[model samples]
Target: MAYRHPDRETIKRILEETDTIAVVGLSDKPDRTSHMVSAAMQAKGYRIVPVNPNADTILGEKCYKSLKDIPFPVDLVNVFRRSEYCADVAREAAEIGAKTLWLQLGIVSEEAAEIAEAAGMNVIMDRCIKVEDSILLPEGKTNR
Candidate 1:
């Protein structure tokens, strides 16, 4: 059977319950979408973990070289990497016991999604978390 993302209500629940987000391929450059989106999430009180090998810090958080390097438990693995690299990120997120794997807008990898689902991780693909959060939990109100 084909895979389907969680329903709108489920997505809202995930957003409300999740606190920490590990962003893979996060860049220090402010112009990048990854940086901008992460910044927005941070403003909403979500802890952002930068996972990039080239950077030491981003958005005032220490950058981890990989998902496995994060010291604390990650509630969500928000990937900014390309679709080709997502499977690896999914594996790492699963290995580290992440509760969710979120692929940014324009990124969709069936293999990665399957891997994450098999590991009991919720998967969100081709959608922006910040947008979802805003739409689903506008002004701190759960639009359920």
Candidate 2:
């Protein structure tokens, strides 16, 4: 009954192929980790959509209160909420048909991961997206 993520190769494939990401709990504050990570992804040419109930816009992109409010399909849902809230995000990710559900560093929920995996969505837990992206790049290709 435990959830197991796919191998590194599969995760790499998912990350490399994803072009758009919906950043749940993204914040407008410049000092916030969510903002920093979103900025990094945006610089890498990935379309970043900020999903936060209080944010109107972050990094020049329009913000949405929830995943369901996003008009277009997103390849990944990068969650920044606490572990206790991840299951809800995972459910919403599945409901909105996101291809992947990623729990940001320090946030992990086995139940959420299982739910996402069961929905055929790729799952990455307790990992920083920026860090993973950097590690996935070859020696000479890394910018960070």
Candidate 3:
């Protein structure tokens, strides 16, 4: 069966309810898409945990080497890695008890989505979280 993303209401609900987002593959460089997207989310009041080994910090948050390294609970696990690596990240996110697994635009993995869904995580593949936030939660309707 094909994987269907959550409906608009569900997506809006997830965006509204989530607080802390662990961004896997986030970069410190301002020019990178991961950095820009994460920054946009942070500006909109979501706490972003940078999960990149190459840097010590991004957006003023301490960088963790992996999802396992995050000391606190994460509401969402947003990934910027390639499709081939998503399953591993999904497993880690499940292990960490994250509520959602979000694959950035151009990234998709059926195996990852299956694992996450089985673990009770809401999966969103091939979508930009920043764009969703802008489009779904316009004019501060669900800004928190």
User: Among these predicted structures, which one has the highest lDDT?
Assistant: 3
TM-score of 3: 0.96
- lDDT to native, each model: 0.93, 0.87, 0.94
TM-score of each: 0.96, 0.92, 0.96
Worst 10 residues of 2 by lDDT: 135-144
**What ranking emerges by TM-score with the best candidate at the front?**
3, 1, 2
> Candidate 1: misplaced stretches above 4 Å?
141-144
* Residue pairs with backbone overlap in model 2: none
Backbone clashes in model 3:
0
**Candidate 3 wrongly placed segments (more than 4 Å):** 140-144
Query: In what order do the candidates fall by lDDT, top score first?
Result: 3, 1, 2
With a 3 Å backbone cut-off (N, CA, C), the pairs that clash in candidate 3 are: none
Instruction: Indicate the TM-score of model 2.
Output: 0.92
Query: Candidate 2, which segments miss by more than 4 Å at Cα?
Result: 138-144
For model 1, residues 7-125, the per-residue Cα lDDT tens digits are: 99999989988989999989899999999999999988889999999999999999999888888999999999899999999999999999999999999999999999999999999
